[model samples]
Target: MPKDVYVDQDECTSCGQCADNLPEVFAMDDDDLAYVVDGGNTAAGEDAIQEEIDQCPGECIHWKE
Candidate 1:
């Protein structure tokens, strides 16, 4: 099954890594925090997104349960 992606706003540092690395699945809001695009779910890019999750400095990215 596909998983939903999200960024913990409180832990977010408004970094652009998510948007810069995965524009197809993530974007920055007006506040500059990364947010998942397109309903926050994707069947593809699991490995790519996981890379983001691993490399995120703030470690705010997550897969929704």
Candidate 2:
């Protein structure tokens, strides 16, 4: 099974880096905060998602435990 990914919206900087890095798992809401895309393929795999988390300037992306 793939790990789930989530964004701490409060900590989001509206930078759109997560979405740009992995649109399959991340998106920007109207508020421009990064969110885990609904019904999207989080199955892009852990390393891919983690890359976004690591690259996120806001440091808001995380694996959902």
Candidate 3:
């Protein structure tokens, strides 16, 4: 099954790692916080997204259960 990605803005550091590593799925909003894009929730970019989640300094990215 596919997973849904979410970002906790309160814990986000605005580091841009997620956006940089997976632009198709993540992007930096005007507030500098990382957010999941329209097509972000899926298995298509799961590996790359997981990489970002693993390396996220803020540890704000997560797979929605």
Candidate 4:
């Protein structure tokens, strides 16, 4: 199964990189913080998502356990 992804809102910096890079899986909320879209295509694969996580300025994105 694919690993699930999420954003730690408390740690989010509202950078918008994840949304900018992967709109299909991430988006900015009304608060301008990044959030994982519901029913997002996690099948976009781990490497792609991990790249965003690695590049995120806030480092708020993570894989769910």
Among all windows of 10 consecutive residues in model 1, the one with the lowest summed lDDT is: 37-46
- Could you give the C-alpha RMSD of every candidate to the true structure, in order shown? 1.4, 1.3, 1.4, 1.1
lDDT of each: 0.83, 0.81, 0.87, 0.88
Q: Predict model 1's lDDT versus the native.
A: 0.83
Model 1: per-residue Cα lDDT over 1-65, one tens digit each = 77778889789888798888888888898998888887546734678889999999999999888
The true-versus-predicted C-alpha distance at residue 50 of model 4, in Å, is: 0.4
Candidate 3, residues 1-65: lDDT per residue as tens digits?
A: 66898999999998898888788888999999999988777635678878888999999999888
Instruction: List ranges where model 4 is wrong by over 4 Å.
Output: 41-43
User: Who wins the TM-score comparison?
Assistant: 4
Model 3: how far is 22 from its true place, Å?
Answer: 0.5
Quote the positional error of residue 20 for candidate 4 in Å. 0.5
| List of clashing residue pairs for candidate 1 | none
lDDT of 2 at 23: 83
Per-model TM-score versus the true fold: 0.87, 0.88, 0.90, 0.91
- Best prediction by lDDT: 4
Residue 6: error of model 2 in Å?
0.4
